[model samples]
Target: MTGTAGSSRSILEGRGERSGRRSGGTRTLLIGLVADPGFATEIAHRLAEELPGALAERSGYRLHCRVTVVSETLSRGEGERIIDLAAQRRAREGWDFVVCLTDLPLSANQGYLVGDLSRRANAAVVSVPALDMLRPAEQARDIVVRLILEWAGELPADSGDQEIEGGGVGVRSGVQPVAPTDEDIDVEYAAPAGRLRLLVGMVRVNRPWRLVWGLRNAVAAGLASAAFGLVSSVVWQLSGAMSALRLGIATVASLAMIVLWLILNHNLWQHADRRDRVEYRQVRLYNAATMLTLVIGCGVAYVVLLAGSLATGWFVVVPQVLSAVIGHPAHVSDYLRLAWLVSSIGTIGGALGSGLESEDSVRTATYGSRERHRPPREPQHT
Candidate 1:
């Protein structure tokens, strides 16, 4: 009985220790992330998940983050106003910090800004599109975490401290160098022209997936081309007659037709002004990504056409039929030739299909979001 009692006492002691550890006080931080509509929302959500874990690990604080995606486009001109408005919202919503994420390319003194922070308001603005990698969520989260860490004075001294208008040291919040003034409505940050282009170069190196757009168009074009080629093959009676060079030429021709159609029909080649070197580079990168995706899409269409032709020949084109039609016995090679011929014709069909796609649809398919929705420029008065 004494042994059992001692064992029970030991179990209770262990339970008490566990309870004490579990009840340890942990600081709770509430963060609000505001994102522009569309793909930015997804990135915001991912940041919400990733930021809290990273912050908790780094600062030993229990962090809670929420994302609010807004439909109104964020403009550089309206940045301060937005930050102030976010501050107001924070007061009502009980958010300790708020950051607005946008896709619009922002510039100030011709340099790009990754984000801006207001120590007084405990708020910030982050340009999601300006970030150079495909994983915007991770990068945005890191930027926000760095801002929070700076605010908390938890970073190392060598980490480039920032001095803001409010006489507070800021970390690498990615804000412009322009100091804030008394006017709350003034735009405090500016990204230079070439910064965005530089980001594109980084994206090309680190994350090329960000540049991929218009998958639906590519798929539609490929399918249409394959179908067209299949029908043409049936009509022309060209089964089992194509050589390797002929097949290769057919594939190349089909891809070329689709690419040419897209270039002629869409604004894929539009660029920023000539004087703005950075914007030009951005436009060039965009065009390069579009063309690369287009080529890949055309290639998919060719493969589909070939597969369909082979399947059709195997199931429908009998040996007897081949002997009668082409004066030769049907074989696997005959089916392959049929498929190759059909894919070539399908490429032309893809061109026709390209015309049917709307400009808006193509843009949506190619780019997750429109460049910017700035107000129309007023007519210049001489």
Candidate 2:
């Protein structure tokens, strides 16, 4: 109970330091993680971060475990290939367990698979994309733990220690442990979803940054910037017309439009159940996050526009051009007006950027949705 799961912070650094001191005497387990680059790296880091804490609780020998990514992704039907490669490399570069993670959706027998392990090969592959949960990293961690346990024969094959909702199947082995009472069985098998929720709760205990960058928020922001640029000119003119109040109005107007666009099209609250629709409080939270993201994106766009305008103004503001355009040397007010004008337009472009991005991209970029509640699957042969 003392080593119970709670925090998901990166224990690698601290644990590595401690483990290094004991390496001379302690046995070491090297885990190879092959993952697709982008989001898979996040999962790998999360796994590394949580592994020490999660494993500390399990009864085991005092061994040092080091997790390394294979620097490549494996596609469907590539698990065995990776395993073979790992085996080949094992002679020179040894690994105790090799787990491959891919962002690609994977299925077996037309059923989804979050991950699968083969004890004979001491290798495993996890489909990060197929994992549906608010905190997928923790689920991935749990699967890895079970796989390790099963491989070590720490738990019986029929222990039913691991479970996933939707269509994922758990690894099984021939080893058997003592039978549990009917009540214990019920408690074990009946708690799949509950355990998953608890794991997520544990993973997210103090992590708030996940919400900001969970989905490809960076890509969304880029798309927003692009979209804002498209209609930026028109918005700039309208703002210019309000010359006296242009600066204040332009900033507010642009930020508002970008936030509105995200809320409407980002599917931030598209719950599967009508009753599960976000409440007013949740709505406020989502809006606040959206506002923050949009403001940052829009601000970047504004700065770029301002810089470009300043460069253009500097390069083209000869005496003749100034005489023709303003009948005076371009002043600070002129530059300020130009900056305000372009920022207003960029705001609209940011909205356009959101629309330009595919729905899937947007979905991949946001983390406020609860789609991870999708039914889990029973595991099948890959």
Candidate 3:
């Protein structure tokens, strides 16, 4: 639309209504924050609180920005176009502009995409996973404001933070212009850093912290094993004799064992034959995200086990009894070592006990499972 001279463009000069004026009075323009469930919806809710004031401040009070969140998963249609979906939603819901927030990792020009704006349709798509994991809500807010301003031709051309390539089909920072077949007037992306950020965002969306709750049985079994190990004289002597390096190795091995167990047992690893390079990368990102989520989830579980073991060992074990078993005086270091060793053993035990969890339950910790279950609405494109 931007390439076509005087083509259909929306919200001319920050007035979101079709006409440039609203009865010569400030009109409340609706900005829809369409988000996928989970992390995307959470972020959208956060955005709604501050976005109106933000839009007013950024636009110099040129338009009254009112945000409304629509929690729904927007899926890909033929040729990977999502603007059609946004346009349909915008029209159906009577929103002047729409910003679809999705945790799904989007690719453009064979790399990572931050978001895209269609001037004519007044709809944009922002991949929440493409943002930095640190304060992603703030980042999304800034990006949304920038996209809206860019659509309305109100943002200055000199803003060095981002600039549309050829003022047409690409975002800055190593993103190339869209091909002739692509309809997006402008798109945003990150280059070398996009992969890591996207991965982090996807993991966040999966809410790996919830995995600790999901693995309650694993925790129970781990604690039971750890309780038993605390009383074992052989464990006491072995922990005192083991070096720190060996203890560290044990910790890693235990965590890895459970991570691998969860992946294999739940079938979290994604597999597909994608001919397109972009699709292949997407699949790889999903697998990487799954691995990352499980690692984090297991890591949290391990930490909880370690803390519990430390507290239990501190209170339960008598220094005199431990010294008698280890043939030396039990010091604070000895107690620490005991906790470390016990936690590791308990993690391994938890891996075994993980069988108590159903595949459906374990799948909650994986990105692949979430994607598989995300409902895709039928195409409403004309």
RMSD of 1: 12.8
Span of ten consecutive residues with least summed lDDT in model 3? 164-173
Name the lDDT of candidate 2. Answer: 0.48
For every model in order, what is the number of clashing pairs? 14, 25, 0
Q: Which candidate has the highest TM-score of all? A: 3
Give the alpha-carbon lDDT of every model. 0.56, 0.48, 0.76
| lDDT (Cα, tens digit) per residue for candidate 2, span 1-382 | 1121111112212345432345444435677777655577678878887665555444254444777765553322322344444444433455666777755433232234455555445566665644545546766776666555445444333446444331123433111122223221101111122323332322232133332333234334544453453234443344334565757776778767765776587665533344644344334333344344445544554566556555654454443444344445556665556556655565566566656555544443333432232123333578
What are the per-model C-alpha RMSD values against the true structure?
12.8, 13.3, 4.3
- TM-score of each predicted structure versus truth: 0.62, 0.43, 0.84
Q: What's the TM for model 1?
A: 0.62
Flag regions of model 2 displaced more than 4 Å. Answer: 1-25, 32-62, 70-245, 269-291, 317-320, 323-327, 369-382
Write candidate 1's Cα lDDT for 48-90 as tens digits. Answer: 7677777766555533334444444444343345666567666
Candidate 2: worst-modelled 10 consecutive residues by lDDT: 1-10
Taking the tens digit of each residue's C-alpha lDDT, what string does model 3 give over 13-60?
354444354544444567888998778899999989988887777767
